[model samples]
Target: MASATVDSGGIGRASLFLASGTIVSRILGFVKLIVLAGMIGAYGDSADAFSIANQLPNTVYVIVAGGILTAVLVPQIVRASQHADGGTAYINKLLTLALLILTITTVVAVALAPLITGFIGLNLSSDQLALAIAFAYWCLPQMFFYGLYTLLGEVLNARKSFGPFTWVPVLNNVVAIAGLVVFAIMFGADPTGSRSAGEVTPAMVAVLAGSATLGVVAQALVLFYFWRRIGLRFRPDFHFRGVGLRATGRMAGWTFGMLLLTTGAGIAETQVATLATGQASVFVLATAWLIFMLPHSVITVSVATAYFTRMSEHAALAKFDLVKTDASSAIRGTTLLIVLASAVIAVCAYPFAAVFVSPFDQIVGIGNVILAFIVGLVPFCVLFVLQRTFYALGDTRTPFFFTLFQVVLILLGVLGCTQLPVEWIAVGIAGVITVSGVLQAALAAVLLRRRLGGLDGRRMLQSLVKYLTAAILPVLLGLSLVWLLGGTQQGGFAVSGRFGAIVSMIAVGLVMASSYFGMLLLMRSAELQAFLTPLRARLRR
Candidate 1:
């Protein structure tokens, strides 16, 4: 087995590598989204149908094994590594059991695809519902591959091999992009989602859904090469008895509950969005969500994941102080980036959103949603790190309770959203997400303090204050530039063509980022310095 011990700065280095991969993957993902937007306009039935169908598998995957594989498996694998056989037996058994569960779930889900599609797309028109069901038939099978990818990735993470997991998603995006390109060439762009079920061909369905499933299959299969390189061999072992299944079950119990509440809230949100403003609203919300997740996936997830294994090891060794120290560093690091990102996103929401959606109206809709969602980004990052800290400590119950409270708030928010004007429903949902994020962050902070005996509250608050202060000038500068260059337009830069829009966004984004970092440097922010130290050293080398 590989050495379980990591170097003192290993988490930071690992986070950098993971962050780099995420940056590349996100760039590709953005291109893929752009391609998708061109193929199916941001607000339409087809876009909504595909988004709903695609998202359902992820929701089901989370409800079933996502939490277990993510929160429960790593710590167990870490514990099992101490055995004479290097946890091979434990790994094999766990893999076998997960595969069995995933296979069964996928079969059942596919068989019930129509029923599931009806529930998710209950507000859709007959044509939209039929298309969604057709997509679900192909997309539902992705649950198995999603499970396989997570199971393999978690094992890699437990062994301190993080790159393969982060980098592999690029392939998934590439495959999807290629498929979309082909579809565009064949069927042309369907910006209005006006394509009827009768017009849809089997070849189109195969290219669309088949390519998606193929990408996941490739993602899961690529890990085997890495597993071999690391000297780990997979063997089919069904001896699930007395192999730590009980402990995993116990951990998974709380996690499953948490997932249930979270997925319930998501379903409610989707239903509200769809019911309030048709399928277009769902697509708008999804587009905004993808942008919202960019910073979280690149910075927060990378930092939290890199720190988690180390934190778990510290907990195992009873080094509570070290765990606290790691958590503090991760929180500070993540907050620094997310705060800045949130500011930039909020200030430049319209122009940035204009890059994705065509037509002035759709751009305005998406931009409004983006602005509302951006306010929650920092708090959302905080919640993410705190949850991982709890998971690292082998305490999933506390996070679940806090999450349940957040979900209840979200459901109430969704209900309130249903009362809004059709045009504003997406914005209302975004507001709900923002409010819930703040509440969740506050609750998680208080609970985590009790769990950790004190979470350095003064330091965290100071960091938040300093980062926000530094961000103010950059945000103002970005907004002023947008106003001067793009005018007070509602949708996007009053640019003529796609090329012009792309150029305008790039220029505006560069100025914002440069000014933001410059302000941080001028403020002599310790977090900024810490973040840049490795880059400086690499330059010197």
Candidate 2:
């Protein structure tokens, strides 16, 4: 495998491209969620029903798009590039095999909608199950399209053409949002979550779930143009002689196990969450998870994704030291921002929830859940880098062991959560999740350190200590400002109205950002410069 030369700032510029698209895509994503919440109340049974069903596509898709594609495809494609045909026949065969799997999976999943719905939403009442099953039928097809998008888009990344992969999600959001608007006009709003399963019509499901599915279709199909530009032609190559599933399965075996473990934990969480249905349960958990992922997606994901290619290149050349350096830098660099973002999100949680749901108790419910999830931001980000680093090193077995360990702990803890009072159940589950994340990260660090003989652990620890110190003043100031606006109190200035929440959140966030960055600058934090150095080098270039 050939290693491409990419200077420091080059990765930073690449991150900028990724982050810019993520920012827009996330904004639209939030918009879509807000609309969905308005359509069905955030804590309502109807909301839980839809959220539960809707999650199936994403859960199945993550197992495919997020896990297997990266685990198997990119390296496979990169290796195939050595052939005289430039990997065309290999890619076509691989693509055909991939689509075939996705198609079968989608069909089977749709056929088993009721059982799948029951598995995740374990405690849903009969009515909720009925409605969720209906939505599942329409939404399950997204598994195929998401896999398509991942297949086409990841090949582009392997080819060093990365723009379309990031940009296409904006279209998905736009299309979904438009469909939501039409659904509102036809079906009317149900912000109170009072819409019963019986009230749901075929038209309602079509406009709602159908729009969501169509968005993914658009996202996947749009990649064909980019594929053509990269000099690839589409053909349904059914000849699967040398390109056999056994080989691919062998390669993806550990990752597939990791995926099942990860989803098992999620199913446990979702089932436990269902116990709090019509309270601060399923829908709130989903919303809070979405919000929790925002900073990670924008900062950690963007930065690490940029660094992954470089690390893989180094790993391919057997440059373990450079791979170690990239992984270390990614963890530290992302954490420097993550700690501050965590502070802001913690302080602004109520107002943030107010952006989506209107009820004061519901706003507080989401806020509490966010606080619970935000506690593990650092560890979560750390684990992300380590997992991707393992992938880059072509070792999925380690991730599986660590992931298996965490999922077991999480399942045990979730079992404990069922005993909590209803109001506290969601928070308990979130806390369990956060704790598992922290422990998993520590385990992953030890393993990677052993494998690489040390991942600059001492320096990384010092950076973490310095970042925690820098975040203290910002967190304090953010808390003080939030208290002033009564962010936690129902009918208070920040939570009284959406506009007020927006204004208060922006004000407090700015103050926190200024104080946090200023403290980092005064401390002469090298971790902070990890991000800046790249952009500065890129600008000069």
Clashing residue pairs in candidate 2 (N, C-alpha, C atoms within 3 angstroms): none
- Which sections of candidate 1 miss by over 4 Å? 1-6, 276-280, 490-497
- TM-scores of the candidates are 0.96, 0.95
RMSD of 2: 2.7
| Candidate 2 per-residue lDDT over residues 55-140, each given as its tens digit | 89979877754588887776667666767887788889888888988888888888898888978877888888888899999999
Give me the candidate number with maximum lDDT. 2
* Best candidate according to TM-score: 1
lDDT accuracy of residue 173 in candidate 2: 97
The 10 consecutive residues of candidate 2 with the worst lDDT sum are 1-10
**Per-model tally of clashing residue pairs:** 0, 0
